[model samples]
Target chain A: MTRATKPMSLTVNDRQVGPVAVPEGLMMQDFLHEYLNLTGARMGCGQGICHACTVVVEEEDGTLAEMRTCIVGAHWFEGRRVRTIEGIAERDTDGAVTDLSPVQQAFIEHFSFQCGYCTPGFVIGATVLLDRLQREPVSREDLEEVITEALDKHICRCTGYIRYLEAVRDVALKTPGLVTS
Target chain B: MKKRFVVFYTAGVVLIFMFAAAVAVFFGAFQSSVVGSEVEEPLLPDERKALAERGAYVATAADCYACHTAPGGAPWAGGLPIETPFGIIYATNISPDKEHGIGEWTRAEFHRAMRDGVGKHGAPLYPAMPYVSYRKMTPEDVDAVYAYLMSREPMPVADKTNELTFPFNMRRLLRFWNLLNLPGDTFQARDDRSEQWNRGHYVVDALGHCGECHTPRNVMMGMKESAYLQGAVLEGMEAPDVTREGLLRMGFDAPSLAHFMQRGVSAQGGMTGDMFEVVHFSTQYMRQEDLDAMAAYLFDVDDIAAAEEPPPQPEPVEVSAEIAASARGTYLNLCSGCHGASGEGIPHVAVPMTTNITLRLEDPRNFLQTVLHGIPELDFPGVERMQPMPDFADKLDDQELADLATWMRARWGGQGSDVSPSDVENLRREAHD
Candidate 1:
């Protein structure tokens, strides 16, 4: 918990980048989330009130992880790597890139977004969440709460929460063992 | 010694303050001698006649009875649910009960509610109540509506439950919303305008909220104030914009819109849905000059687009062959006797199926209902069909009447549809009464 960390070059989504300065006490949330990038991760509130900055971070050991880029530091990846949604194949399993991930597909089918502001962050967070939950499954009540909390992680001013929950429910119901009886 | 002195001084000061406050309030309450004194008489003989006359116009403008009374529920007894994006709002009892209605409302309090979107206790009303429109009424007109309501024979109805979620149940934001929406000023007579035009403008814009339905709203849900009279949709009924430009697109001129308003005929088409009902209950009752003034004001409006009307198509007259002869035979034998052969209609009244916009409409539910169950009260003198349109709902199956209607439409190149008995049955079941 107490150690001095040094900055080093790292690969982000396969792009050579970053010997970027990160504050010693700064959260990972503060680094990849700097300057004009706020435009990418949205300042839905710096207190992590929204997950518009969610990104996937890989550890130095080749193990990759999902992270809210705002609360994590850019320097945490001193010699590590990361992948972002922008890194996904323009296609899916069969070279059909329009092949949206299950979450994106479900979102469209449910008419989940009206203004579509919080969707990108939500989509990324959900992508990582689905991967994490593959090792486990949940019950009905647990499913609704986890899905709600996952999305409640962000703020949406329109379409309310019903359609968002519906989109998640669609994914959970179909993702095989994501929701066990 | 110090405690005794303080107690004596506080008592003397408190009594003087209370008396002064009471005296100031007593005088302030009667600050407007005109308002204070006239209401004392309530309705003098001449005043009663004047008020009743104005009340009729106010009633038409308000369309108060529409939401309150419903199809045949007690007039103005309330209990209708108004839908909003936020939640459903139930209409409150308007019937005079000391505990329920405005029996407790002072005239100023009533005016505030009408013009300010605030109740006497300072709670804001749900916007569905149309205070935005009422805010435009001249004070005197508001007074007239108040007079009309006060004149009604009071009925007692219990309070109904309202269900809205939190933050929305919080009425404070309404005040904030109103600050953004309601125009706080009262209507002042325009020195440059004609008396009739000024009066009509005041009545329609503010008290009538004609624009609330006609004008489109903006991002914040506020009316795009500058583009005042552009058309907007209401409960799926598209109220054509009464503005000059809007009229051109809708294919009407001042004369046409005016003529249509008087009769149920839209120059482009016939009124349907809520507008159709309004044609009978509200506008048809208006004086010719008032109708003329409304048309004039809308036509004379500055931004009218000069446009050509689309060419007319021959009217529709679809009927089923199976029942065509029998239906026509039925109409000639049974209906023509009361309806007249030409369908130009009997003099003074009786809706003509041949050319009457109401009868020639694609769906003849209201016409069919009036014909079947009969209209309430509205009887004509010379025309025999005046008493009731008589329901032959049982006699004709769906297609037989459809064929007859088809025959009528084709009779003079009129547009009509095949009436189905099921449409009749559905209408009967749906009719509130």
Candidate 2:
């Protein structure tokens, strides 16, 4: 009945991670940090109040949902396609960073992070927002609310949340398919 | 024709040179006169006394004694160890002790050290002293601080050597760090801002140096100006964001913030950790008007460009029968006495669990930590002697602690996530460490 005897499997950052046995009580944050070496998903508050340990989980309909990895059990992510902060930026065959995604670029241009401990969660959350906007575009008037709705779940203790909002706003506005005129 | 053209060109060049020379001479004289007129004369006895008194006020505003003095140590006889990522740096003794402190330092030397981050022997000071913020202080204020320190009963406390490692130990290298991060501009009253706002800005941004802790730092340890007071983690505790949105999230208004600053408690909860120290040593002693000004400025200044509607509230979570049963048992045994069976805390005695935001927050670390460590009595004026919560770390196992926390949150908060034994264990280990 112990967590150690439970079988767990999940897709992480577009890769099939495991049908590997994990402790039943193992947190997704531990699986990512210790097992997968995805340290980008930081553990700011183990209790999930600060979304510094957030990741994007793609649902059955291909809609991305943000989830706090810290509080949730690793087994909860079974059969789910989870995207981390590491998956946002493009890399070449040599694994060198070739280009940053629009959200990543926006974060850099706006200086949207300081210590960047909470950045991965913010990036992933913002990415999910951008994806949601592209799928169902909103009017310019409603854009702020949409962005707030998407990102307010994630906490960025460094950049007063203003810069991140502005960055996301910039990306949403600049990208042709995101917003209806 | 060629000779006439040459003569005209030479004549024109000579006239331009003369004009440039006159302009330079005029500016040079103006600058010298300005500098000369601003020079301080030797202080008379009454002037010295007045300046010293002003210096005492400046010292309070600057919170010089907080970092400089060790716990239970003589004022300004610094031996307080400041923890940084690189290493521990000890504050130097600023008392006017002939052998141990700044007694031999001349006024000019003191000013240079304050404004330029240079020591008496021309060595660079570590930014831990916050000379970058102090540099923004007025020359008059600096002089007053010097006079005040000089007038104090000199404590012969020797300065402790810093425990910095490797390259950081090289004091000379701090000069380079200074070049990149130091805010060289002196404090200037912004014309567009109200006088009260400007005063608040000066106190918060310059003299009080709240940003030194509240503002997040870059990899190189420079304050990220773009973020401003967005908030930052200091020694494990999140220095909660002070922005309008952040304040709103925390349920703070101007009055509440001012009250918290002055009395270390608000509707949210009482101050703890570094904030308790801040109130005890610094903010509590500030004038009520100044605290109000700070609150007003904080509430209004740096309004996030985007319109911030509070996040949509999540649907209430339901506790299962089995979990609820165990939680009830744990709660009845431990928490229900103080925080009633209905979680209706006794008014003016115990903090009501229903109104407490700590349980409602997304992270239950604070709640867990509080349960494990207990709340020490913070004797504030006007408020009753709030009874301290006893530490339950030894009495309760992880599962019991988790159950108790879960029960409190589920019954009172109505919308919080579940707490696990692992969560309780992690927090317990952290607290122990």
Candidate 3:
């Protein structure tokens, strides 16, 4: 059975991108890099085994979710607001990139990345994660689950998992509503 | 046209100033070699005499503290969690605890254990203990570490069982592990090399156990004999490829490599992640001659071709705030002394709640237990002084203690599992009952 190809429209990194034409079932990883120059989202594991291609997808419900962009198909992002690591913290209140955001700043301060290959995806995925947690304060189990969910797919081989966990935890405490029950 | 020209002239001046300022900011961001150049720490005449006397350099070179004592454990009391593929294995008490520890072991037994991987009862130890690497230790160095431990205060805590899976926990199976492993031997000076190079090799390979993390592991997680120093993963951390071979792939030239070791950032590459820990523990402590030797050895060696590129890698997780939702109340209730409002705190006196070594140790159980129960007061002879880290077991219940420990670990990006209330209850019982 053949699925018909679909055309999609979306804003990526603030540019009103397209009502572009695309394959019916191309994986999101190929859709982003092959069709769009969104090189910030990488293809670490095509199968979503590694969360290299995570992107922030604004839902129709005015909510944001980090979709691996690799496992999801091209049509899934239709009419969605998709943000890559490049777009996480566009600018500070003062307008120049708020050095991209506290989360990015904390990542730098903590020496969180090693090869830097995975950093963009991690940053994007985390921003979306923190947003969700603020909507509902995370429970202890929720904390573990949320962390596992956000980072579960991202495979970091350096500094182990401690620094990353600490980075998010630090941001959470500062985040108020999200950290405290 | 005059107005436009005037604007252009003024803007040109402004742009020049801006350029100069930008250059300053950009250059300022790069680490400089400049320092006040305090007089280098001099070993006193007596200290020099002590070092020259016999085993002085060995203890210093071996850097026993990097492994055995760095965890703020009862100085030299061991019990730090050592990770292996098999499971989490706690370092045994090297303090003079006779039954539960090494208090009554004979010198010969210690020697055999260090050099031969044979214990006092003739049991072969797992290589995770680094006996394979320690075997290269000259007798003098072994004597120094031994002397240091013997002189330490006796800590009476019993050994914790290794949480290894079945075949690994079976002591007899380790014999097979050892058989496949090349027997460790004493370091022999290479006649072709300079004394410093040999010294560097001996230090990096033997006492330092640099290979334990750098050397790729076999299926069992034992250091792959063929790929020694190629770099591997440990306790969820990536051991940077220290070998010239692996370093080349990462684009580290010799001078830059030496600089990276002496200072923490690569001359060109970024200084991020566990490499900082390596800099803190070993490389930063090195003298120039040793650093040169290490650079030489690494650059001189060849890398066995491994994977085409770094394996499909993942970025560090962006943890959600929900993870800390459970931890926030506990931090407010039990923490906030050393850890501040945002969880940042004064180093040494109080740990920063976020992104610190103390918070991300191999095991927070000890850290939690110590914080709750307090550290054993120590005032060792011939040692510099430090304040005792207080314990909290007295005031907090298991749930509260668990919550605090879990909160602290989660709060500051500590990379560990949350301690269950049962774990806290068990530890509380073990400590007091």
Candidate 4:
């Protein structure tokens, strides 16, 4: 029997990558790994329960939302903009990482992850929260709840969630205009 | 002017008299049904133990604990808020506490509460107690349940106040409502039917009170007898028509239906929403024989074991190539990962859409709601388990979601692409609210 295929094209990181032919039901995680060679999103549960395979999808309104890559189809990202863990850091003209994003920096400072298998998802979650906070700033008192609501979906088994929460909280508190008193 | 004033005064007086008479008659004639056999000699210790054991099973079948127990609270201590159209009504504490529960009540009082919807003090209970269905329970079963309840150590949880709106808050009105709705006769074994069918009918209608939710309610919020088990939409969830025809159409024979009840998951997909709670609390713990009996009764058969095989799977429907192609893209993008490329769901991860009972439902409310909101991790009995399904409300727009739903229905669902963009928007709004 012949395998069914579909044409998919999407912008990843800042580069437009294919109207390429992919398997009809190829997962975004597999596409990131095999087709684009951008495999920062790790496959943990592969059932979308664990957010280890999360990536940031840029919405039509220019808002960034975190979505699980392991469960979403490659074609689902057609004509859309996506950002993987590999694209989160600042890069030079030579395409080399120059600086880590604030979320990554905060995660390092707080030592949020232990095995680091879940770090990418956490980073994406925190980044999405930060992006939302930019558009709609949360109150100082509700910042903790807001942070929990955002990062709670991503599971980190090795390290308790305290460090990750503290790191996210610090990022939200330290950032200007993210948390209003 | 003088004649007009006299006529108006006379009319007003007549109306007042009529209202008073109506109220008096309603109250005076309203009496709790006198049920149960005459008091016999007290049972011996061993007999009493056996009775209590049977009562425990009866209570489980009745699902008394699901309603009576609050989340993370003491079992049977009540205070679970049941939401109705009118308002929220808290389930009462039926524990053996003297002050807060039914500790001081006699056996007769307990029977009356179960059958007549009347409290020990002659106060009428809200029909939320489901006494209308419990009325068919045998006196022996009622006594057994009483014994089982009385045997338990009582908690000191006081009953929470009900927050019913307007005339529903008036407990006295329930007496009249009960008069109209409550069935008088108890369950009787039909000689023409096999013993298994009668037993199944007893377990389902009397003990299980399945009709309380499965049967559609009349305008007065009473279960419609004429449409028994024909399905009802309660609290926005569609309890699919479970009549013999409905069951057969949904690819359920007696064995499969029993399996579905006992295991909570079958080839027809796992129970979700309110049915999930029922399986978790009641049917999963039921005896296999009773489950078989229920299946028999539901299938309108004499012996479930001898029933024919489940209905044949339907042929995949044909749809426009464009629609199918568009839907396949969306399905791959959002659904294919867990549910599979051809909607043949991954084992233990997701249920296959090919035989999904929800897709076959004519009303797409549950199907749309499930897709938009998604089900959390469902852990059923034994090895059957399903991972959490992610909600697509934010991910897919109304039109996209509509196309996906319509496509799924056309391909696997034995129906047409009846879902519209407006349907998605309305369902999303309702779910949000």
Compare the candidates by TM-score and give the number of the best one: 4
Q: After best superposition, candidate 4 residue A67: deviation in angstroms?
A: 0.9
lDDT of 1 by residue, B113-201 (tens): 77766676867777777887777666677677776776676768765677888878777666556656766565676777676667567
Residue pairs in collision within model 4: A73-B333, B68-B78
lDDT tens readout by residue for model 4, A44-125: 9998888999999998899998889888888788899999999999999999999999889988998888899999999999
Instruction: Pick the lDDT winner.
Output: 4
Q: Candidate 3 lDDT, tens digit per residue, B1-433? A: 9999999999999999988855553333221211112213333445434544344335545555555653666765666777655688777767767876677776566776777676768666767678778888776566556655665578767667779888777665555556556453457888886665676687678866778778887886667878878666554345656665556544456666677676653223223334555565656666777777677666663221221232121122333455454454445323442345466544433434443434444355545656665543232222322234435565456766666666565545334466778877766666563
Q: In candidate 4 chain B, where is summed lDDT lowest over 10 consecutive residues?
A: B36-45
Please give the distance, in angstroms, between residue B217's alpha carbon in candidate 3 and its true position after superposition. 3.5
Candidate 4 lDDT over B1-433, as tens digits, reads 9999999999999999988866964673646475845733444557667899989999999989899999898878999999988899999899999999998888778888898888889778888899988999988888898888888889999999999998989887886787778877778899999999999999999888989989999999899999999999887789989999889878898999999999898779999877888899999999999999999999999999788887777666776776676777788778877777777888876888888888788888888888888889888988788888878787788877777777888777767655789999998788767
Per-prediction TM-score, chain B alone: 0.60, 0.79, 0.54, 0.93
**Candidate 1, DockQ to 2 decimals?**
0.00
- TM-score-wise, the better of 1 and 2 is 2
TM-score of each: 0.45, 0.58, 0.45, 0.94
* Candidate 2 residue-wise lDDT, A1-181, digit = tens: 1223467788987789888887654677888988889889898856455788889888889888787776566766778899888877898877688999998899899988888887888888888888888899999999998888877667766655888888999999999988999
List the DockQ of the predictions in order.
0.00, 0.01, 0.01, 0.64
Q: How does chain A of every candidate compare to the true chain A by TM-score?
A: 0.71, 0.93, 0.83, 0.96
Off by over 4 Å in 4: A1-3, B1-21, B32-34, B37-50
Interface RMSDs of all predictions?
40.7, 12.4, 21.7, 2.0
Indicate whether candidate 1 or candidate 4 has the larger lDDT.
4
Error of 1 at B338 (Å): 19
